[model samples]
Target: MFRRRPARELSADDLLTTLGRLTAQARAGAELQRARVELAEALQREMLPAALPGVPGVRAAAAYAPARNGLDIGGDWYDGFPLPGGRLAFCIGDVQGHDVEAAAFMGQIRMGLRAVAGGGADPGVVLARANELLLSVDSPLFATCTFLTFDPVAWEVVAARAGHPPGVWATADGRCGIAEENGGAPLGVLPGETYPVTYWRLAPRGAFALLTDGVVEGPSFPIEAGLAEAAKRVRDRAPTGDPADVAAAVMDVAEFTGHTDDAAVVVLCYDRADRDNG
Candidate 1:
């Protein structure tokens, strides 16, 4: 998408003809691609939580960007919902492939994970069940997901990572770090083993970012370098209007710099006043 630079000045007739053809071709291609993107994005959007559950003290926003120039769909997804006992569930995941089938499998995984986690399972238990569910189905697809439970009252979180990228945490005090969990192999590849959970406390008004590997792993750049660059940008960028905007901007930057993978992210920002004032 970024390869075609804007046309420059040329002699009048030739320029007009060339520009006209190019414009028509670009317009046609863009329209066709846009239609496909819209369809894929619609399908992908179905995987996200339709409405972020109303946590008394929290307001959240989220965004997803499929690959810009590819097959118009991807296998990354994010979801947030209310957990029992007034906690909130936040998660991001990705199936290995980027086709429609992968996307369909991705939707299944998203719903399955939420269902398993919604049943009061701990992060580890949730991942174990998810793995089992995927394996028993006889499908060859594999997915990586991270499950996070946020406690608004305590500003603490319990997270489980299953072959997914580590989450990013940006604190109210301006400190940021990757939330590392004991991630197991991707689901559907292994069965009968328990995934491990990690615990951490978010400083008041902290922002937690959960992302797919596409945010870091692409064909061009090393994953570590991409991650480092992304972390720096997320930390340095001024706090935006909403969590979704923050997440989208990060992905935008990554894609702008030529990362072609389908990137997806979910950002959770907690407000201290909401907990304290209550």
Candidate 2:
């Protein structure tokens, strides 16, 4: 109870101990930050498939490149899910940012697409519903996208674009061109925007590619030139190349562009079911 013991004098050893503790804390904090970044990147990467879904007469392949100029993950995503009547819905989009928040928004948008697309609905309606879902979320981030339903049985395509670059297509005879950008505003931007439906026919051994702007746009390279070059490369590979190889060809367009953003490509190649059987 007594007189308080004299305050412990600040000795060199005591100072050293305190400094060591602070250093350790700082190191631990840095490590924690690194871990969090890694986790976010992994989750974002996992959201997009490493191997796209496969169906009879339709082979899908994808290639992804994260942003080379930043450590944080960017928000480019693509997926293929089964639809009713042996059809499949494929989407590729770029959410606006290179951070964890963008990735989270991307996840929500993808889930909404899958949920609304279950009935094999028209592509325009599907996009409109998805836009509502995105708008309802408490986020400022918006996305540009192309959504489409492909019927492997009919070799038909019904697609809708939302303020995004038009997709590219190549027939078996080496004819290739880009789609018309008849798109509405990007998702989560304007309320009640309408996405127009566009029809396309896929010939046997033909291919369609959905890609983000990163694959064809750069500071020094114009998208127009890049797209033309991409079409040529894709047409060169679409006839006999595997979907993976063809997807790479699409990505290769950025080589001259020197693109620094994240890039993603999903290629859908169509072949007659009877081709292998015959």
Instruction: Provide the overall lDDT of each model, using Cα atoms, as 2-decimal numbers.
Output: 0.75, 0.85
Tens digits of per-residue lDDT, candidate 2, 1-278, equal 69988987899999999999999999999888678678769779768766777676778898888888646677899988888887888999999987778888888988899999996679899999999989887589999989998876667889999988888888779899988758899999988899999988767678889989999899988888888888887889988748898999999886668988988899988787533554
Give residue 154's error in model 1 in angstroms.
Answer: 2.8
Tell how far residue 265 is off in model 1, in angstroms: 0.9
lDDT of 1 at 256: 43
lDDT by residue for model 1 over 15-48, one digit each (tens)?
7998999999999998887776676667777766
lDDT for position 176 in model 1? 69
User: Which stretches of candidate 2 lie above 4 Å from their native place?
Assistant: 1-33, 273-278
Which clashing pairs does model 1 show? 61-244
Every model's TM-score? 0.80, 0.86
Model 2 residue 101 lDDT?
Answer: 80
